[model samples]
Target chain A: MLADQQFLRIPGPSPIPPSVQLAMGKPMIGHRDQQAKSLIKQLSPKLKPIFGTEEDVIILTASGTAALEMAVVNTVAPGDEVLVLVTGAFGDRFVKICQAYGIKVHRLDTPWGEAINPQLVEAYIKQNPSLKGVFATYCETSTGVLNPVKELAAVVQQFSNALFIVDGVSCIGAVPVKMDAWGIDILVTGSQKAFMLPAGLAFVAASKRAWNRMESNSTPRFYLDLLRYRNSMQNDTTPFTPALSLLFGLEQVLRLFETEGMENVFTRHKLMMQMIREAFKAHHIELLTPEDAASPTVTAVKPTDFQVEALRQTLKKEFQLTIAGGQQQLKNQIFRIGHMGYCSPADVLQTISVIEVALVRIGKQLELGKGVEAAQRIYLS
Target chain B: MLADQQFLRIPGPSPIPPSVQLAMGKPMIGHRDQQAKSLIKQLSPKLKPIFGTEEDVIILTASGTAALEMAVVNTVAPGDEVLVLVTGAFGDRFVKICQAYGIKVHRLDTPWGEAINPQLVEAYIKQNPSLKGVFATYCETSTGVLNPVKELAAVVQQFSNALFIVDGVSCIGAVPVKMDAWGIDILVTGSQKAFMLPAGLAFVAASKRAWNRMESNSTPRFYLDLLRYRNSMQNDTTPFTPALSLLFGLEQVLRLFETEGMENVFTRHKLMMQMIREAFKAHHIELLTPEDAASPTVTAVKPTDFQVEALRQTLKKEFQLTIAGGQQQLKNQIFRIGHMGYCSPADVLQTISVIEVALVRIGKQLELGKGVEAAQRIYLS
Candidate 1:
């Protein structure tokens, strides 16, 4: 193992790019300075494109979970009914946040490692005509399943007036999300994921419908209050002291997105997803999420021939490459690989080759070069 | 003007030491990695001396405001009667956060430029006898007044069983805070102030008395939940993704505090505060706070002969130096000089000299070198 390098391959808190690192390390500046105001003004418009919305994107110095709480507390009041589509762990968080605030939740659970069916959502919406809000996760990080957010959004709008909110924390920057065009009322994401920065900042963009609900809704809140953020953005700054270093890193991350072009960035993620999935298939590994429901950001694999922990330990102990194991119930049953944010197709190839060697070392029957060759062929295509 | 250099003399977002800056710029690491756990384990104990507490100091990936919110929601439920001592703008924020969460606030407002009288607090505690919590600010950044928290704690402990929570945002590290021995139930601080880092992380240390209160409280909170943080610290990690870059900076900051022992560090801040106050006295400028009430971290000065805005502009334009003007009601009426964390005796002298020059340029009657000479005498003494 190399002494100086650690390959961070988690789904979120992904690898930070070099230029973004340099930006974060720059000397601190006054948050109220004209330069800070300029950074704030430039950031909102630049971020709108990634969110696929023309609405102002509110910047918060908080974790992605705070953004999820903001979504719950701002629009829906306590005792109000809402529907939560639970595909995985992140979606369940919405249920918890809502229930914590006394919002009655009508939860619909999809099988693990599978996407939510849009027809089921339509049926729920039809049954609960008075549901004030509908929550969904765009990319479920736990099971590596990408739900059809557009289809689900269409279903909500067609059947009911419930405001549609999507937690896009794991895939907003890597995928195409038309929040404005698709009638997604509110979309939330964090910097640690695809923004290629540390985990201190979260972004939220809201439709006018969401804002109207917030104004009329009298949920008691302070820090997670979105209207305070909206009022501060009018002056081109944050309501409280901002995370200046993260903002510095965000400026550079935005430049990276622009330089690559949003379309190209999306294409790269899709390509890496294809390469890794094809490689896993060649190794005869049991994939957790079916190919049709797989998320482009992360993929789950179940190794039946050898212990999953043994394979993971071998990879970490030998190559210093880290992959996440399944969370909660999936623990000891499946291992997950994250290939998003600052990740690349080259990283995918390198990871598959290392896994192939690791499998052989763990006494699993596997051809050493087969996985690498499969990924390479897909990369060339 | 030098295009590359700017002296940030503001109270917060302070000038980072070179070592802390370099530490923050280090490459990213996984939040769930063994190294990350090691970091979390190291940070809490090192922070105990700063808070003067034996309890675990919870690290949060948020601005200081979130810590304040956490203090409110965790211990006191809505409709619980609490006494908030409003010494300045920050104290008013406590009132707002309380009222927002439907907590019944019995606010006591002190004059803007003076500290709260302990006698008044003792009397109020005797009258109410049943307040569930008493909130106070250690350093009022808005007015540069240092509240006598030790005395306040004594009063709270003597008369009532109310939990005592302190907002030590601006002065916890520069001064002294004994959360445990002082009978303080909770103390909150932000990294941007005396921690010598960027504004992404906030720390909170709580007494067992406060935790007992939280165990029975039913206020709804998710993101700023203190119990989740306490549980996660047991596992040597944050419940959510942490601000890894800021943690890197904090490790370096702890080293700085240790290298210059805690007592010596406090003495340095005392010296800076004395030097600046004596300099202002030499210039015959008006000081807003009484000598006994002045904060070691920041001092507010009101200039009657010259516009505060003009002096601030002259300093910025001529020397690229930035100091804060008064906030809210005192805006354009006073200017503040901050001398804490990463600041030195040399910086105080340089700042005094620059202000002397700026005073003369702004057509105020001030002899050159008078302020600098006065500060020099204090340093030598």
Candidate 2:
């Protein structure tokens, strides 16, 4: 293996494409310069289709967690009740943010590897008549589960008027999210995921109703305030200094998105996910997430027959492929493979072949080409 | 000028060094990967001397404004009183953050072009012994005034038990801070300023006394919570995803600091400031800041000789160099030249030469090379 050629296959940050790297390496510009403002002006409209919303996507120079906090703080106040649908770690993040802000949280936790049921969400809304907001995750990176946001939104709207906010950190650009049509009040994502850039910038889009709610929010906030973001967006400037290098990479990433077409990008991610899932099945591995609920960006495998840590170590030591082990409660129980952003089906095939090699090295009894053959068949078909 | 050789001479985002830019372009790694953990471990120790503190500098993936908010929410809560020594726009940022958090702010507004006097802080502390914190800016970026922080800290400690938090966003690494020695409870800075990197990461260091106060504070916060950052630092990880590209740049930046030596770095900044200030005097232009209180990182020029906008426009259109215009109330009133981070006396001389050319173009009468000669004298002497 080349000295610096490791395959980073975590939910995020995804690998930086060569062009994006060069874009990020471009010389820094003044945050207030016209060139910078023009970059923002161009990025605003270009970013909308990815979230599938006409609302101005406010770019924040913060991690995905900060974006989640911004979403919560802008929409709700202390003493207001909110329901958080805990699909996995990221969903739990919303709960923590709400509790931190003194918002009364009612949690609906699904099984670790399963998405929240829509009917259950409606039932929770029925029970809690005064919930100010409902929070969820689009793709739980920890469990590799893709929640049915559209169906969930429909059920939520039918039962109550709580603002529907989704954390789409792992799957926003890789999957189709119709924020307006599906009635998502706020959608948040980060650059390091399917946006194919480094971590720094978080993109958040809020519906008109959410903004209306935020106008009256009394929570203590300064930097994470969405109204400040909105006011600055009107002038094509950031409320504070932005990460210019990442914004440069974002321009290139958006260009790439436009070239590939959003639909094709989603299709590519879907294909990669399917290939990896099928490969795991061929190797007699159980998936953490149900196949129907599998994330298009990441796959979590629970190897019942062998040690998950051993396989991950072998992959790293021999193949230079770094995949994520389980987080929090799922630690040491499963391994996750990320196939989002600049990743492809061909990349998935290579990963499968490498996994096959590492599996045998880890004392797993397996037919040599079984997994690779399964993945190839899926890719070609 | 070459196609992309524009000089960014703003308070921030400052011009990035070429090596730092390339380092930032390094391949993305998983946030949980050992490589990333090791990177954090290496960065943590290397960063301390810049703040002149043995205390761990918590790096947050957000702008400087977020860092200020983090500082405020960590040590104080709603209904708590604080004294904000408003030197300029950035000092006002602390007041805004305090007000946003429902903290009662007693403002001590210095004249825009002048630094806060230490006596004023002692007077405020005497009157408001119930103050939970005292906020001050080390270098007011807008008016280019460097407040006497060491004296201010001494006065605050002598008179009050309130936490002394300083915003050093525009001038931390470029100058001698001596945070621990000076008894500062908290010192905050950002990446794009004296750190010689892109705008994203914010560095904050706190005293033991500040941590103790935070333990008793009842502020509701999550993403900007310093305790979470402190907890994650023990394991060499971030509470949230870090700006990985910028961290990579930070590695290179640390190496640069090691090679140059921190004392030399401060002296370089000092010399650059003197050179630029002398150059401005040679042109008979008035400075916004007093000679002793002028910031080493940035210099604001209040010119009665020519139009500020015309000179700035000429610099951009003819020379491809960007000097910052005034911010907020100072907007269109003064032109500011940034001379921090990767900047040198030679760069300042070049800037002086460009300003001379632009001045001639913008209907100003001047002897050519006079400003450049003045800067050269200061550099050689």
Candidate 3:
């Protein structure tokens, strides 16, 4: 039975490298020790280069959602209006968080499988000049569409006072977003995605502009407050006890990212995306997002006359392949393949082979080896 | 040059066991997958026996402080009166968090090395009938004092509306905390301390009565919100991406605890504490906390004439031992020796040997081989 368990084929927690795992296995250190303070201080500078921003980055002992909440509560006060572009599920979550906090939200909703037009976002901002912040996802994990954050940032940059916060949770290391150069104020990322670690901690880079806004904002924040983090980071320690094991894992993973220049890392992600796209084309499957808007991380494929649910179930049951399904109403209509951290050409080939086999079992018309052959060609030549 | 890193000897992250380290290296699984859902569902029931509570225990991908915020914000509202019994730094932090949220705090401050008098605590509660919550720490890691939570909870029980919240971050699995039997309402623990894993996740158990208070509370909580955790726990998932690696480690560690019976775990901790106390006493050093109030997790020792800072530094330089220093004004006044987590009687002996060397270096009168001999008498016999 495929039930004995196989490798993780989902985007993350990606198959951890043996070295990273070994380092994580190292005995824990006290969070307040001088040795830990030295590690944390050294870590902040190393992360600054990956973020491409000179701003201070704070690591929190929570997931990406906690980091996102830190930005939202810090930049936008209780009564302020925030413009969120909902191109996927993560974007919709930003709206939900805002509503939960009693903040006025202006949603710029696009179709689930498409990217939002930057001009429309700019127009909305112009209409609502009093907007305190604009929120967008760099790579919408749900639809596998990359929002035009660089262009959107330009529109919000003109306001100067309004903050541009991007949820780079899924895109930070795999893609490039020059935080200061693009006028982005707050950028939040999680370790599970591109950073190639198990999901736990979130990294945030806040500009002085965002901190200025946080000075006057009061929504009763204690745990998610960025000011406390900013203050504690100066002393080279967290305000509270941190998840030491995950931090240990992250330190090694980030070191690997540094060893391989960030540009090379992004280039590798793009290559993986190109290889997947070529294989999908060979299989006669339609990709959800347009070529220019497609993310370099995950790809969503619309099903043909094939029974998508049966094919997905067969892959899991027979081949032990774990892929993602569309969320909400799109579930079962599309299956997504992830190519983020710790993924390689072999992983892609194996996934494609399983998909072809599952499709054949479900009575779908497909050449058995076409997708794998196409992916191999891209990998080798 | 003592440049290369040595093992961490502070309280936590206590050196992780080899088995626990290997457990963390496993690949990730989608939190929503049936397999993952089943794993989480299984994990919850296993935690109930360890927590000594019939109530549901919620897991958060955060440090110990995050769990504290979850219990505080969820149970106490604005303008609510909270009676905080402070014995050390962590207890002081609880008061600071309460004040930050505009909650009226009545601080019953005891000396750093002294435990709270249950009679005084009860008298204060009787004096302030409007108190909504009573906050205390089970083991004050900063000063090595263990407050009598059961006796204090008895007093808080007299006030029907007052909820008992305990920060068992440093003491949980290493000591006995009977949640239901002791009438504790909200109990929180961190993964790094006593659990013998690296820090990154917090485990919180809330009573049904505490959840009822949350339903009517008007605190602005989203990430640290217990309501969201309670809602999602019903389905065996968290509202956000949890630190999956830490969870993997936690799952294995909890199983280990169950295999060795909870009572056995408590006995081991008590034995280690007794060994440490005896070793220090043989060296003619005094423990900072009273004998009856000493925490089973860590021991705070005060030297007769040596500067605590110099002795601590010398131990690190000469021997690779890492002990904690006094907090705030207590700095250089005392050095803390932690004997929790993966520590054993042997580990305690090694630490005592280092302390003995440091004491001799400081020209204190001490017989050769006295400390180790005393520890062996308590442990080996």
TM-score for predicted model 3 compared with the true structure: 0.51
Q: All models, DockQ values?
A: 0.01, 0.01, 0.01
**What lDDT does model 2 reach?**
0.87
lDDT of each candidate versus the true structure: 0.87, 0.87, 0.81
Runs in model 1 lying further than 4 Å from the true structure: B1-381
Residue A109 in model 1: shift from native, Å? 0.5
Rank list by lDDT: 1, 2, 3
What pairs collide in candidate 1? Answer: none
Model 1 per-residue lDDT tens digits across residues B231-273: 9999999999999999999998898888778887788888889
Q: Candidate 1 on A1-381: residue-level lDDT in tens?
A: 112235677797898876787788788899999999999989999999899899999999999999999998899999999999998889899999999999999999999899999999999899999999999999999999999999998999899999999999999998999998899999999999878889999999999999989998889999999999999999999999999999999999998888778897888888888988988898788899998898889999987878889988987875667999988888999999989888766466557766766777778876554665566557556
Give me the displacement of residue A36 in model 1, in angstroms: 0.8
B82-138 in candidate 2: lDDT tens per residue? 999998888888989999989999999999999788887787789889998999999
A13-54 in candidate 2: lDDT tens per residue? 988876777888787889999999999999989889888899
RMSD (CA, Å), each prediction:
26.1, 25.9, 25.4
TM-score of predicted structure 1: 0.52
Each model's backbone clash number? 0, 0, 4
lDDT value, residue A342 of candidate 3: 73
Q: How far does residue A145 in candidate 1 sit from its true spot (Å)?
A: 0.6
